[model samples]
Target: MKSNNSLTPSYFQFTVFADYGPLRYLFFSLCLLIYMIIISANVVIILTVCLENSLHQPMYIFICCLSLNSLYGSAGFFPRFLMDLLSDTHFISRPFCFIQMCIIQLYLGHELTLLTVMAYDRLVAICQPLHYHSKMTFRTMLLLLMFVVFYPVCILIYFFYLASSLPLCGNKLHRIFCTCWTVIELSCVDTTVIRIASQFCIVISIFVPLSFVLYTYLRILLVCRRSSSDFRGKALQTCLPHIVTFGNFCISLCCEFSMSQYDADEVNSSAIITLSLEFLIIPPIINPLVYGLNLPQIRKVIFRFLRINQT
Candidate 1:
């Protein structure tokens, strides 16, 4: 195995650790296809939502946030992943790894925060339709955005500070992308606080938002039962994408968490492959497919755009 013993005094750093052999080719191809589709679809969604005045509501605003966050999150890692795979290089420099981890965490944190806000928005719209206009205004959205962005930055800054302060022992990352927890795991010192911090972050990011979304959707469904069929159908359709996205995310997270456990001998190939699919491949590939394939508006927009381009 290659090592991180040698070091240069340069402030800016770059490292390559491409040791996956033939799997690199497979990974590069998969990442390229998924990255292209995700970027194209997310860009179209955001632009269409922006261009159409009718879509400038709280629901679409949250959709835009989801699209933008996924776009940024996937773009930040996937392109480099493909590039590194193509070049047969998997190592990331300390600073570059930090930047990548920060971007990933920031976008993910935005996703969680936006999900919570979306739940609240749904609650207001469904439970208090008369006051939705007054409640989910532009100013409220802006505040929510700030909070979402700020909370993640603070969390990451502390993580990077702690991570960088530690003396490095090993730097060979098992996965393609640079994750904060994985990087922290390679640290020489005790990571008790880091472990606790990570657990706290996961609980806040996953369960709290999950709980709100579940509660809001449950209440919405209950109320929908009393409404006309047409109204009920529309409400259910609006919530389907959210439910699907959350489910996929939860599955991927569980897979990731499982793979983080290791035997002292080695982490093994099967676990790595499983974790890779869950973390790197599935979310980017499946999320847009789930949301885009189901949504009538997105399908119509995509078809129209393709037809216009062909003509």
Candidate 2:
């Protein structure tokens, strides 16, 4: 067996131990509860959409995709996290660390792009209802879904490749989980090239979709203004959930980026972990609730299913 000293250099130690102290078990239990809720809630939404053929429209399909993405994102972080909380040595292997970083990045990219897709779907449904069916055909939606999944993975892969190629002077990552920027910071050599590449990836992965989402919503607002009260109400009922989800996601993302880039040193370890975790925790739970409660059809189906199961 390898000596502990020999193995120490091969892994990255988590800094959360300093923050949690005696409360680690309590924290772990809380996270476990939240994760279970996240998984169950998203799964329910996924099944509801799948089983209810009435939810076969583009809007509901996109909601399913969003919930699926939530589960994907949460899975990437929570399992490893819960394990770390239980362990005495909060260390992760180098390869595993890189893998975690990639998953988190991919999750963020996929989420922003997916939200943008949902925005476009809403815009077409409200502003161009006449052409909505023709425009958002099965083929069109398939392509959009493909893009939603593909683009993020591609961007993250490139960035991960670049980050992995760098020589690390040290192995200690300050955050609870491995993030790409944190990994990049641990590199010994100049990371100017990697930094530029990362910035480019961030723009392509986040800002482009954000711009499209904003423009789509602007057009949606214009269309709703000119239409009758019934149209406006219907649009609000459908679009509000997406808007709230998007806004919450964006705010959490902004906090994550801000903390990682600027406030890592200034913020307490516990605060940083909480902020970093918000994107993973809040969005997964809220997305399904927002959609299930706000979308009448989904709410009705969910209630009907619960009633049947209760009997």
Candidate 3:
């Protein structure tokens, strides 16, 4: 017989899956319905933003990008997740796990950077209305989009470099899906360096954007206070949805980070699963609804599209 130490795991088993028995089907059906809604809702916003000439403005374009990112994040997790809900075996291959991690990390990073840029856009629009058009020009938006999408990619490369060579001591993951940190926890050797590196990544990837977002809103708030009531109401009308979306995403992110880093080893698996999935489920569904329904321009265009489809 081969030595256990010499054998590396080719697949990781998910240990967090609860035995729901007959209720699994009900859970699967509900999740499938949510996935469908996420797709359809985000797609409608994307199509409306692209097709309507009036929506080519920076605000609408950023909203479209949020929907696009939501679609990307949802596609990464929901299909595999839906399958797992109905599956008897919850195992994922090593390579596919890495791919899923990349998709999720990219989605998270892209989201924050995109939100940061949107905050900047609103800052200029509300605080410096005369300079908004000139400041957020076509080239500027293109460069910002490039930064938002690519920054996460660069971080993923470094993360994989640090993690790829670590010898695995086990193959059972205590979560529903793959994550870099979870996999790193399975390493046979001490991972102090890797953990620190990850913290650094979090500060750069999460904290910086979060700080910038807060700063922008502070400036916006100050401007609102100094202006008339009419101006304050108009400013709130423009910034409210973005603020809600940003805050919602931050809370979800906090749940994911807190559960992953602090509670992963010892927490009740059943309890963490709900909050873990909340980050993946809530934001994608909520983002488009908040933006599409609350914003009159996108909502008007979406209604027009629906009317055309019906007729």
lDDT of each: 0.70, 0.85, 0.86
lDDT of 3 by residue, 1-311 (tens): 53565346778888888778999999999999999999999999999999999999888888899999999988889888888988889999888888888888788888878988999999999999998889999999999899888888887777775555677888888888888888888888888887887888776778888899999999999999999999998888889988988999899888788786774668888767888788888888888999888888888888888899899
Q: TM-scores, in order shown?
A: 0.84, 0.93, 0.95
Q: For candidate 3, what is the TM-score?
A: 0.95
Off by over 4 Å in 2: 1-9, 19-22
Measured by TM-score, the strongest candidate is 3
Ranking 2 against 3 by lDDT, winner? 3
> Model 3 scores what on Cα lDDT?
0.86
Among residues 3 or more apart in sequence or in different chains, the pairs in candidate 2 whose N, CA or C atoms overlap within 3 Å are none
Ranking of all predicted structures according to lDDT, beginning with the best and ending with the worst:
3, 2, 1
Point out where model 1 deviates above 4 Å: 1-27, 263-266, 301-311
Comparing candidate 1 with candidate 3, which one achieves the higher lDDT? 3
Q: Using TM-score, rank the candidates from best to worst.
A: 3, 2, 1
State the weakest 10-residue window (summed lDDT) of model 2: 1-10
Where in model 3 is the C-alpha error above 4 Å? 1-7, 263-265
Q: In the order shown, what is each candidate's alpha-carbon RMSD?
A: 4.0, 3.2, 1.9
Give the Å shift of residue 77 in candidate 2. Answer: 0.8
